[model samples]
Target: MTTPAAADPTPTTGRRAVGGMRALTLATAFAAASGYLVMLVAGRTLGPSDYPLFATYWGAFFALGGVANGLMQETTRAVRSARVGPAAVLPAPGTGGRVRLLPAGLMLGLVLACVVAVSAPAWPRLGLPAFSGVGVAVMAVGILGFSLQAATAGALSGTERWGLYAVLLTVDAALRLGVAGVAWWAGDAGLGFAFATVAGTVTWAVMIALSPATREALTRAVDVGRRRFWRNTASAMLASAGTAALVVGFPVFVTATVRESDPAPLVGAVILAITLTRAPLLVPLTSFQSAIIVYFVQRRELGPRALAGPLGLVTAVGLVGAGAAWL
Candidate 1:
């Protein structure tokens, strides 16, 4: 017979929650620093006009990528939560199920790359300034990298392996810095800065794929319910888009509002201001958002009624943050 749900048998979950918070704190710090570095490096290397354009690349990515991350957060919590049931024994998330998305992720990447390459000429129609064909292609490829990285984050998160998650964040940032440093050296800020993100994420994806745990997760006899997986994926994508609008979609607004040849000094400040203000929310809060999701999921009270109190608090905080960022 299973231990009564009322009796908390595992000290493991409690310990991991505490430890995960620490890792998350560190991860948030790493993400913030690296993101700023990417921005600053591009600014220094690319100069004024190019800076706004590069920022646009990130704006689009993060906004859309939020959905990908949403997928990560929910998947992690759901997968981990499943193991709590005595009969639901399965390979832990980081070990195998993570890579299940790999083939699909790659296909998605390929599709996006083709779209970007094809659309390179019609950028003006998209209202983005015409970038070099290579720059556009690199941008699409970076998006592909981020998709794999985001899913990996979900995998590690599901397993409550905070330390590895922290490493993922730190490594991604550090590698970006290194590659951006190279871009700086090359003095080709535009495409070079784009290269930094692509390189960092590609490597991180490889890192996760090769982990012993991932190997185990794959080789084991697993029971990822087919209907359940697709259902969860659909729900996760919707949540991802909603959450992203709250956080990452700021750039899209900025991109749409500003004219390509507007030549206004305020335009640059607009991008910078949005970034600075959003960082407090996105970097620290959003980066560790899975922790919040997992916490609620574990409690068995994740429904709308249960979430009311916390969501209200988040809304208030978000408003305050927006005002502060605006200032």
Candidate 2:
């Protein structure tokens, strides 16, 4: 008794979905490759003496940014996805349209700034004070940029435009690598490289600002009122910052504990090795995370079947990769 419409194959839709997944996979791969390249170039060009400072800056920026991103992910996946209205998710209008994220941007910024201050004294030994300043600035910008990017990606996933999201990420990575490469080539070791990050952030911010969907989200966020926005943003910041510390703090600890003869190269090599081990897994991880966010939002239940499959796959892949890296 099925109608012809119901019997249709819808093969086109399937193809489009596959295409989107392919794009996302390619984009993530490229981004990881570019990151690896940047690390290699920085280590080789800057050498051990300068590389530590470079590592410090890189670590701080990514760590803070990761925290900001984590907050954004949680907000998009859990809070906002729960249909909890804009007033509960975004910032107030008078606050320059800044999203009133959990953990409040100011509070998060202050904490990050404090961390930077504590870490600043070590910069001179690495060859530059300006590097420290640039590192802080980059981290702050990255916090904003990464959060926005995650928010946008969340929205896109909701709409199932995974391909577009992937493309944007790829573009962002390409820009970062391109800028950093140019700076490294020009022999502007410290400042130039930092400025490149600034450029990339500006580019990403501008792109997000101009996107209609992002603009709409921002508008909703602005209407969400200061209190609610701050509450959520603050929570997100704390969670994100903690996660960031875990990921980036290790290298700093290693540097501190290790001998001073040539710590930079060692740290850089370890980081590079880690990056390589993780690169291939990123696409799957990203896809899995995105899918999980959507599933949790829609279903309100974290089924074991859903969890087991991805977890097993990720663990198996990670183990194999880790083994290879260790070898």
Candidate 3:
């Protein structure tokens, strides 16, 4: 017979879940707002004539980072499943062997960095006159930094360390905003904004150094073996690449399709409009991906029925958003 106190633990657990959700929501809101502000600052600082250059470069950087984002997603699932035991989707880590995901992600990031560097000479032909070898070098460093961030973020999410996860999200966005603000105040243009775009990738390192829990998360092992992890990561990257093309990379396409004969201000305005209009609807949802994945994984025993509530909520939100847009 279960004691009443034991049976009542669900209430406490529910409360904690609610609290964590609030924290995550606040952190996501801050990130979205900060991103919008960064775009605004970039436009003002770079002005109309040069803003398109920065916009195009920004789009390209994120499109490439989609690969890293894919790593993060799989890491989240792999780590969460490992922690949740054998009943979950992915296999659990064991005494037989453990593969640290961060190191693997870093190696992959290095390979990507090399590829980017080797391809730098071709960037100008793709419409980025400013991205010579130096720009590519900066991008390589940013990719490496982001790979570190993605692995750490996945570990944190898998362990259900929502506090640290929220902090990670908040700090990354805040740092980017601060750097952009500094660039704006200093009157630096496209190059400075490029640095700002990639600046937050170092947040994971700082978090790991300051928080012992973050450091401990780095030790968390994924469920899959190395080869399987890489294969899964490649599939995730392909999906994320498509997402990146539709989301951030749309600006790159828009910039590219605009001929030199097109007016510069018009191009910049269209890019900015697309960014601002779409971000509010998408950024928070994207930021919550790990959390959603974790939620569904925990409830996998409930099967497909578990998705009903979230799907309904998303539908409601989408309808409201569409109506607002129409108005």
Q: Largest lDDT belongs to which candidate?
A: 3
User: At residue 199, what lDDT does model 2 achieve?
Assistant: 49
**Best-first order by TM-score:** 3, 1, 2
- For all the candidates, what are their Cα RMSDs to the real structure? 5.2, 7.2, 4.5
User: What pairs collide in candidate 1?
Assistant: 76-158, 95-213, 95-217, 96-217, 96-218
**Global lDDT of each model?**
0.64, 0.57, 0.79
Clash number for every model? 5, 13, 0
lDDT of 2 by residue, 1-327 (tens): 111121111121468657877887887778778877877777776775666666656665666666656544554553334242222333334644444332343354466556656766775553445566656566555555555565555555544455666767777777888878887888776766665554444444565556765444433332244455556557766775675666654445455555657555666677556645554664356444665565555544545656776578779987998898799
What's the lDDT for residue 204 in model 2? 40
Best by TM-score: 3
Q: What's the CA error at residue 246 for candidate 1, in Å? A: 6.8
Candidates sorted by lDDT, best first: 3, 1, 2
Model 3 lDDT tens row, 1-327: 111111211121477556767788999999999999999999888887778888888888888787678888888887776666333233334432456777876887798788778877777766677867667888889888888888888888777777788899999999989989999999986677878888998998899889998887777666676667778888998999898887888777876677879989888888888888888877887788988888887788999999998999999998998898799
Q: What is candidate 1's lDDT per residue for 1-327, written digit by digit as tens?
A: 212232222223677667766887987797898788777777777776666666776666666566556556645665556545445444444443432655545554565566667767766544356455666767787768776766666666666666677777777778888988999988984667667756666754566566765433222221354345546666887877877765666655665667657774456566766776557556877667766666676566546676777789889987997897699
Candidate 2, residue 207: how far the Cα is off, in Å: 2.5
Candidate 3 similarity to native, TM-score: 0.90
